[model samples]
Target: SVSSRSRISLIASTVTIAGAGALLAPAQSKK
Candidate 1:
């Protein structure tokens, strides 16, 4: 159960960071 929860949170955090990276990418590229 602990492993499963850790995996889920890891995936969730990865997705959140990926989304934030996507959102920020264009701004960075524009500079």
Candidate 2:
């Protein structure tokens, strides 16, 4: 179950980072 849980968390973090990156893009472009 270690590998499975790690994979799930990895995916979740990836999604979160992607979403944050998306949100920051517009602000970055304005700079």
Candidate 3:
């Protein structure tokens, strides 16, 4: 159970970072 929970958290963080990067990439490119 613990391992599964940690894996889920890791995936969630990766997704959050990816989403943030996706949102910021276009703004940076426009500059």
Q: By TM-score, who's the top model here?
A: 3
Question: After superposition, which runs of candidate 1 have C-alpha atoms over 4 Å from their true positions?
Answer: none
User: What is the Cα-based lDDT of residue 23 in candidate 2?
Assistant: 100
lDDT of 3 by residue, 1-31 (tens): 9999999999999999999999999999999
Return the clash pairs for model 1, or none. none
Question: Which lDDT tens digits does candidate 2 get at residues 1-31?
Answer: 9999999999999999999999999999999
lDDT: worst 10-residue window of model 3: 1-10
Worst 10 residues of 2 by lDDT: 1-10
Q: Model 3: runs farther than 4 Å from truth?
A: none
TM-score of 1: 0.86
Q: Candidate 1's C-alpha lDDT?
A: 1.00
Each prediction's whole-model lDDT (CA): 1.00, 1.00, 1.00
Which 10-residue window of candidate 1 scores lowest in summed lDDT? 18-27
